[model samples]
Target: MLKKQFKTTRVFRFKRFARKSYSVFNSLHKTVTIGVLSGCALISAHATTVEPAERVYTQTSTDSIPPTELDEVVVTASKVDLPLNLAAKQVTVISRQEIERAPVRSIEDLLNYVAGVDILQRGPHGVQADISLRGGSFDQTAILLNGVNLTNPHTGHYSFDIPINLSDIERIEIVQGPSSLVFGASAFSGGVNIITRKDPESNGFAKLEGGMYGLFGAEARGAYKTENSLHSLSAGYKHSDGYIANSDYNIVNLLWQSRFDINGSNLDVMAGLNDKKQGANTFYSAAHPNQFDDTQGIFASIRGETGGRLKFIPHIYWSRHYDEFQLYRDGTPDIPATYKGHNYHRSDVFGMNLNMQYASRWGITSFGGEFRNEGIMSNVLGKPMDDTIGKYTKSDSRTNISYFLEHNFIFNRFTLSVGGLLNYNTAVVDKFNLYPALNASYRPSKSLKLYASWNKATRMPTFTDLYYTTSTHTGNSNLEAETSEAFETGLKYIHPVIKGSIAAFYMKGRNMIDWVKTSSDALWESRNHTKINTKGLDATLGLDLKEWFGANQPFHSFSMGFMVLDQNMVESGLISNYVLNPLHYKFTAALHHDVLKNLSLSWNFRWQEREGSYVQYVDSQPGERVDFTPFSLLDVKASYRFPHVDLFVNANNIFNTTHVDFGNIPQPGFWLSGGASIRF
Candidate 1:
């Protein structure tokens, strides 16, 4: 049998009235806050602290090596441009070369190769991917685009599906460990910052690509540069019929960035907008796969920078997201025989972020602050007022503010940095949340380095966990925020040919939140358990063998990387009904070679194995069962490039492995996709 849920006649009218009133109030409040904050920040800059940002590498090169020897790779790790080798933390860079050489179709595909990270996929394409760092859950991590936070409001468990394509990205930065001290909420796990490409040519370029699975895409960019100013604009769109049932997606994005020199200082402004629509597959069902889940959203951000001794960066953004999915019975097919039920949710967020830094000969210091107002509306089961068996209208809103301070001190052969964060959260229906953290790093020698950090992070309860009420799932209003105290230490070694690093970490969490069946009732309720811990080690060794490929022709380059991760839960409780523990190992290799005078070939290979654990679930006998299984996957890609066009092909699950990756969900085996991009 099927069921349907809808908004009540009077409630619909009330919603509109409330929205109008709220908008007016929001505008007035925002204007006043912005003005006051800007004034206070300007005044504070006079006595600003000094802090150096982490460094990143956009290209491959050395600092002292003249331009004749190599090209410099500049990064914003320390908030200032610096060489990659001098970065304070473990930094991973995914260059444009790497993007073009892989079969990556989504953000998950682009990040799956990184060590100490886990990507849980519901299937291929934009369906669903739970990205975790160091055993942290999806809600623990923070996702950013162009340095702006993009965490979804409906559920912290999901992030804004990457708006741009592989071709649109210039590079990706993955900083592991607790970064909330630097980036604010949702950075409890780690942080992923995606930087898009700027216009590359004065004459402009247009690109078109097509491939299997109903995939096709295009991008256009142009730029103008003069003595005092440079202006650029770019736009791109992509669409595809995903690899799974009811999985289809489309995305469009536009970006504008400009820089102007005023007197001795400089000004930078960047603005972007994105709209995406993707399927969710069968999120809550194993009986039927065709229930067709859908997600649609729009996001925009604008920021300005002042290039001064005391640098000032301020930005603001807005996001509107709406998602809906259908529910069906086990015996039913993809097409619903009757109206089972539906879940509809909408979320909107308005936020402001500001950062400042003071630099001198000695070192640099930095401080930043953030404020956000978030609102939510949903048509889940059981809210305030409704009468459809188990249907209701849900709504909640809240605001949060956070601030951070840090300093970087540089010496002859070593560098040290320390930082801390303070957060204040106010919700309309619950108690306030306060979070704090501290981190530091040290370099013992050029070839050897050590790092350590500690943090107190909090993960707020999800919307579904706190407000949902249905036949299959129940919600608890009385829930506390989950908190964690983490500590980590690591070592790094850099050699001329072989470079690698190792890190070990331990994190203990209390009031861990999960759902468990009630003893008296047949419904599930949210509860907190004490003492849940995660401990693991991460290691990576990549050997560069350009000399082995050829003496000095710029003919070839090869590198290989390997990683392993183990995660477990130490606390015992019935509410902990997920994959209790997971073990994973992965290896990847890349080879780039010149095929002809103006042609090059790049080949990439990746293999991964995952050891799964038990998930609490009711079986056919209505008894709980434990599942222990193993799954593996292999992926490969080859690319050939010329002056006008670049040809590429990717093969996923090359071995055609038929074993199930998702417990009850069936997935296609051995899929292929190929495409080409033409540029002028």
Candidate 2:
């Protein structure tokens, strides 16, 4: 039996922004204050922000899918979601079916194909990857889980330490631009939101896999349904001996989700955990080949909506992350005298947000606010502590309060939206700052739309950037927040036979943060660099051959994307760890075709040229600087479908190409993997 979603209903609405009547405004204000403080969860009517979006990617052993409708897809970066056709920002989506058919395994790998998004991996299989958007550094993007911020206060490098199993993801959506005016700080460059919605059509699935380097794994997911409630569970564990010495990893993930109907409102609750242990050879510094890392993350959240004309959405979440890193392996033959004890850190985040909307003849007005507290306890990253918890002996904490209000006006084929976020952070001097945004879209025809956007954003320094101390690196607690003002313009065309989009963006940044050293002999220090300006362009085109010509066409679909980026920064005899090694040029292409009725093949090709250079470290010491080298990779996947079972085989880096994504870190070569799954 398949379960269906339950929705609430709104029968009335006022025309203004909470000022229908003075008394009503006061009552609503009191209600909202209580909701935000007491951690209440609410959901709008039938269709609210982030409505369930289930998309199909292929036609193997299943009925054919209908063509995509532009108006049917919505962007949820704001309190009031808008259709993609009328949106001023561009969003890239990776559907569940696409993930199932891709040659990639980890979420990090899947994001590599995106044009402006970069995933620099320190280890394979989602062990540790730094995610960046546009030409910004990894920490500039806001990482979210089901719309709840999951960013780590310790460092952005651990932002991908998600607790949910890979199989539990419903979709991954990327908004490739600053959303500080929309989703608040750390979305300075972009936002990546992972949604794990329950699938009523799927009773459950189980799978097993094995590959190179003695890799093996098993995973299972199940969904149960009742009249007014649904429950889901997912769990997975994998381990390998590693492709090289000390590169092995073991990972375990577990997640559970439940939803219930309370009167005319909807209630959602979820919890998950992810534990990973891996060798971090050359992950941070290449000076030691025996470096290792272990991390455990736990998170839980609740959200829902309740209201009549004034739709209110309340969200509350909590997450804790524990991380331990070793500069030298525990069993190292000889430890350097400069090597201090291992680094141990713990980060905790608790947050609550209240969003409300009112629709009237005047347009749609949305207002919301969020309260968040992020704290870290670390041996090497924060201020000294009076007491110790386990191995941690230092601590620091900060609170951020953000409020937002926006008005959306739609006149025929034209749409305009203006909003801003009033933000105040305890770590940033406790002063309020306003980040304003303006978005407009014009549709001259049914197939073509032009959009433009302008916004300002800022991101706070992480614990590691603030107070970390070591032999090779030192932090600055006086470092100011990084800020940027960006502008973007783009055009998109949608058709049954062909779909294409082109966009260009420019950003002026101030107080940019980076770890730099005057020379190899000096310790790396975190500093706020001078003004840096960035500009970039990206274009994509896709063709559906089967729809354009006939069903007998040899190829089912083909798509390609290209991107170019430029940034200006120069200093005499200065060495930078990040910000310099960005993608200068990137190209990606994918092709899918049906070899047989039940057999399908997908081919993926990517080429990228990186900028800047990295210093080579040897034997626990910094050596000479090495220039980056460009690399190309090809991957392939084949899938065969049966009545109730699906079998797949994939090969990554099939041509045995050697590459380096970060400083002195060598990437894997050719690898082959296969898997089988049974679906009920």
Candidate 3:
């Protein structure tokens, strides 16, 4: 309820994007808008009745309309504020209720149930995981916190290294497609934004959890609110002896957030810090069973919106990630000195943006520019350094500039939006490139809506991909930036008893990057392929059993989802590492029911078929080539309600089905955990 009331995007208008240099960028921005609109031409469609220009632009946005059954949930679509039904792209909203009731312990696990999103986990309990959307690799997706970019510059493996506990989240918004125009080049496949809680009343909670394998965890959160401001603080710690030999982990998280209202506008500030010491046995190479890593990260951002008839937003964000990865843990009696030391890295990212928008007789016009700097200092990840800093001797840095222009139009039952992005990266390209987008939606009735969108996005290789080198691996500094042109069309149906959406999409990628080698024994090198095309179908259906069966409803909710993807790449003899292999088929189902007056249960199940193979290890050596096989997983949770607390227990991988999500990494089986929440 607080999330629905004090939505940051709606109230503060601290939207994602904005530009500087009005006079210089204005002409070029308008020309791009004209070019895209002319190329798209208006087609037949229907939508909600357009409100009068003056009232619609000012009133519909400033005032909050109570959401109905979560169907009309407000979500940010392509950097524009729009309700779910009005959005042109496929967007998924995971509400606070869903997070509280779900049978998952971490944010990464909850996202695995979504239709188009993918979470490839090497270890559980927030140790490490790679997130992707649609059929793209983990590196192609952009992860944000509170609309701020916190993704790592060294590698996608650290993108999920967020510094906050799952209890600190309020809601999550996922846009499943290319959104580079707003989130930048990394959003080639999609983007996910985690919004933190903003409580209006004074409240707090403390939780404790424990399970098998010597697992133990504790967390606490508190929030205080004044008439014009709100502040919150949360901290947590978790440890596990692991389900297998050398798979243990220890993690600590701390988070702080605040909001202040000044005049008619508002300001929001948040920061987080987390530390991790993990046993990553066989995580990267199957030959090493004693692999270990230590990670420390900090992310902070401040955003403020202030304006009258025209809105202006100023934002500043920064992140620092430090990692020490050991192929073999200390004191392992290595064979050579080259293999005796650990790899150390430090990445820093700083960004700032200024945005302006206006609403008048014409549709809303928004324009903004961003300046970003990404730099890395490491022992083995960048160019050779002439001077040393601390223990790092190598370094690299790049500057990126991006300008955005977007407009939304409403005419009776038709809604349309056109936008374009201009970007320049000093590390990859010499000049700015144009990435254009067009989206439209039609609503023939209250229950059914049709939408279509076409978008383009590009991604530059990370520091790891550009300079990493070793005896068994090599990096190609000449690799070109990859690009994708995507088109999607979908229909959403919302009814009292049945609510669902189905979409079909296609993407054409050029100059795709992949780790390849001529044969199994050759060194792995990064290379760019000519073209790769992908097509997929994603659908989800939810049934409100309560509405159908009245008080005797068999279950409170039931949902099922299916996704199939096929990718065709240029035929070659290259042995691919990341790009070629992906999930070809995936299906998910969920059921939640009340067993008694105070007891409830939830069942979650999924089946996946992947298209790839890995060199299986035997007796500490690569023995057999094993192709990926289909696997199924089932998870269930039981909860009992009390006056001020809830008791819950969950079993993941209940069937103990052996499966492989990433190369040479064996997933846990039949794990159980329990916890209790106390509120005050």
Give the winner by lDDT: 2 or 3. Answer: 2
Runs with alpha carbons beyond 4 Å of true place in candidate 1: 1-83, 202-207, 224-237, 242-244, 251-279, 328-341, 381-392, 428-438, 515-526, 547-555, 571-581, 591-628, 659-661
Model-by-model lDDT, in order?
0.58, 0.77, 0.76
Local lDDT at 657 for model 2 = 96
lDDT head-to-head 1 vs 2, winner: 2
Model 2 poorest 10 in a row by lDDT: 5-14
Question: Can you list the residue pairs that collide in candidate 3?
Answer: 18-368, 18-369, 19-368, 19-369, 46-442, 46-443, 47-413, 47-443
Per-residue lDDT of 1-680 in model 1, one digit per residue for the tens? 11111221111211121122233334334334443433333211111111112221121122111111101243444443334454566666777767776666677766766756677666655446777777666766777776667777566545845456566577777777666655566676677777766543533666666666787777787788888887877777878787665666777767777665443233445566666655545544433455544566667665544433355556666777766755642234554345646777777887776766554444556777777777777776224543332232667776777676766654444445566555666853444444544445555665666766666676666666688766656687777776777787777776656667788788876776666543323455666666667777777765556644445565455666656666555443342333333446666666666656645655556566655433333331133434535556667666676777777677777788764444444455777777677665
- TM-score: which candidate is best? 2
Q: Which stretches of candidate 2 lie over 4 Å from their true place?
A: 1-49, 52-70, 570-573, 618-621
Instruction: Score candidate 3 by lDDT.
Output: 0.76
RMSD of each: 12.2, 6.0, 7.3
Candidate rank order under TM-score:
2, 3, 1
Please provide TM-scores, in order, for all candidate models, with all chains considered together: 0.79, 0.91, 0.90
